[model samples]
Target: MDIKQRNQNAIDLTFQNVTVTVQTKQGKKLLLQDVSGICKSSQITAILGSSGAGKTTLLNVLTNRIQNSKKVQVNGKIQANSTEINFRKFSEFGAYVMQDDVLLETMTVRECLQFAANLKVQGDQHEKDKVVQETLKILKLERCQNTLIGGQFVKKGISGGERKRTSIGFELVTNPSVIILDEPTSGLDSFTAYLLISELKRYAINKEKTVVFTIHSPSSDIWQLFDRVMLLIEGQFIYQGKGNQSILNYFSNQGFNCPRLQNPADYLMSIMHQNNKNAQNYPIYFQKYDSLLKPYVEKEIEQGEKFEILSYKFETSFVYQIQQIAKRSLNNVKRNPILFRARIIQAIIMGLIVGLIYFKSEGRSQVVFFKLIVQILIYLSKDGSNHPTSIRDMNDRNGLLFFVCINQLMMSLKPCSVSFPSMRKVFIREDNSKLYSPYAYFFGRLIIEIIPQIISPILYGLIQFYMVGLNDRTVGNVFFYFLCLILNSLLGLSLGYIGGSIFSDVKTAVFMSPLIFVPNALFGGFFKNRKNLASWIRWIEYLFPIKYSFNAIAANEYENTHFIPSPTELLNLEFSKWECVYILLGFIIGLLTISCFCLVCNRKRQQ
Candidate 1:
């Protein structure tokens, strides 16, 4: 849709007598009291206020991020294009960037921009790349296009100012008409801050995008860039009018003389103080100021000049988000040779360890070591390695192994522990674009992760099973053990993915992995026989993949022993080899299904 066609004069935004009351330790605190205003596309509105003036809260209300509490009632109307925009759909029309920078650290500046562009745009690679490069030049980040962004362990990107610009760049890729940022110039030097504000001013003027952001005491240079100014005090709107003149006029009418050769930002801060001895005590100063500005704001609304704007419909597709995310993941994997090198090294080391440990043991000891190998394989399913270094850096390792085997298993069964907590960011971004179905991402992750998860554990089992010298007749038994390990890995990955989605934070996701493994470990017949164990434990064992895996491996190893009859006879235990295989497969499928369900649920929650 063209900008002019979408920009209807249908009340772009209106706050009708909205009141927000928050309960604090002090008592019922009225954070916002009967506040009302209108934001139009043709104008850049600034929500200026001192700290704790409810400016941020007001913006949150506008974006629908904050819910109204019992004490905090919103008794008013919020209209966008004559349609009531509640908290749920507010994001569909506008973009809101909080004060904090939340970009991925591993991605380069160019990669970050490209990924965002890919998600928002529907075009060939050439078109998407062209848009991304254009956005980089606009944000003045072209110099550091190859630099990495921020994270806890890494800071390889440009300065903080550049990071902020990158965030704006991401939003701009979508070309939303309403752009709201909270303290965009925060944490920057004066010169850089001024330059950033100037750039935003240019964009507003040239592009006709409504820019609304909260700022704390801006410099005069920065202040001049604003098209309009809003003064908020203690959650109440004191004044909303044309830039510096609003501040000058408010004080002039109150009989306060403006200081010569002084910054207006400082002057306003001085006047906004409630406890200052020199503070003016004009009769009902706040109430009178609100009364004076009300008529002008209402006049702007009535004139049909308030809401008219260009409607730009940017269609974002699901295939694009999936393709972008997938491409990014694959590129990172390809670029970082160390990631694969480590996995290969891990597989080799595990093969050696298990091979050497079980080299030449007799009957019962060999069976015992075989079970040990199975247990090791199960542990490997969680992380897909046996080396000390692999175990140490397990949290940072991101492969299909963790996604399909470890994460998926936990999320499917426990759901509380395995999923990535940052899943919210992905969900929010995807929902905004109306891109890929939740199932697509989930299934894609599962498919991508399985190879890595399956290969390592299977290699370890096979190498060890053969090196330890199993009877020639029991080759099929060794194969069964390998299948069991593969199944367990799939189970772990499925649980882990679900856990990661449920809890986005790594610490929490890792913390909850064992919670899921414990039941499987116990029920898998680790410490006791299933029949001898508690009735509840036996019932639980039926659901644990480990039980079938362990049973299959044990039957394979012990079947042809002199103490036992024959391999065929051993296979006739309570559960046959096919029974074990089916059970293991069932466990994998069941956990995966649940993980997919959780992903859908989580996506809905984000929407």
Candidate 2:
């Protein structure tokens, strides 16, 4: 197969005097000032700068990742040949390897490559496997093909250098015309960094792919691999052109002569500090160097303006993208057995604990039932924290009596509630690929997560309901209680998912989840009489799944009791078991609906 024939050409990127500015609280800040450069097919361009030199920001401007900011202003054209490519269009032409390696750590090396291949190409299983194998070989990761990449939980994969290579391989599988990588050599030793740059250079020359990446202080070996270099200083383009020899000659012409024993990388670092008060002598050196390069920079700009656009065509299918995403998701899940095992263990532990707490009750079991209700309410509302002093004494007394009594509750809720933020990492990876529609992902999660939660809660309810020594209630009542527990668990899962989605970090999410649960638990009729609650608070009860679930469970438990009719005497004062079932189902459906709506809104905002 002719790879070059299969690939798209006519891909030339141009930035004409592109300036990016942002307004900060302190004042206006310039991220990129009148910077201009070109990236084209068949060449590798290295953007060289020190830390905070705005190289990444320039890339963001070229890719259209930056949004409108009061402090941000752009005044230049970024075009692909004749067609002006905005951020979105630029995104379509290339894949960006961000500074941070964001990958599914649970996936193995082979699985990760296959996942990318599936997303980037369409073919039979055999063809896809071949692509994955070839990519792994290209990265020299064949030896660790089956190794799981380290995550927070699992640390048993390739080294940092290999991980970076894996990231590049993912983008390469897509066959993007231009690959933009940010600090690709980051975290790698000098030898590995040299090898990585050499590999990239060979790939660009041999395969005719455009390689654009940023590097901070490259070693001598790595520097020799670049065909072109664009040097940046304080958000300005200090230099842009071909060859390390030319760069050295340009500096020497300005009388900034290099010492025989001095490293070029170290010399450049000193030049970058010319503006600092401590580096007074370097200012004179930089002035001479800057004057010598001014003419060359002007000539490049003139040549850039005269360049014409090239024409090319690319072949891709939407269906192919979808199939790739699905395969990747499935393979990733299979490769990470620890996650599956963790889910199972959590289900079993929760089931045993809840089951032991709520065992069955005998005749006139209202007191025992009330105590069980309070415990459930407390557990749902609080995050394993000590109950307040007001409630602590009552809890201790209840424990001593072993009999149920009405308890007054008073506790200071924390500013934030416990939440699982790490789930966001999973959601983000899935969300970015457009793997499944928002609804599909939501439903998939519902199916996978709801089952374990339902099973555990039901097992607990069943064990507790019978062991507490209830009267001769039908087996149907036992099932009804289990249904209530299942609905409650669904409610919790929905809340957790929503919380995870809204917050970018786990710490913030953890703090927020309980705050959300507190109001739901309060209005669920666990603490106070639903009828006697304040009118406004009573309105909140209608919106809470726990309100209905608690009511359904309580009504089914007290079905045999009699109650007075309302003053109008027009409606039944007591709820039937059938009514309880309907209410529980309604609550579950309502929460699920809201969860789906939240997800849809979030997806739109992201897009």
lDDT of 1 by residue, 68-95 (tens): 5565555666766556776545555577
Best by TM-score: 1
lDDT on C-alpha atoms for all candidate structures: 0.62, 0.59
Q: Against the hidden true structure, what lDDT does model 2 obtain?
A: 0.59
**Candidate 2 lDDT, 295-394, residue by residue in tens:** 6655554444223332222323545544444454455446654544554455455444443453321222332433655444443322211111233332
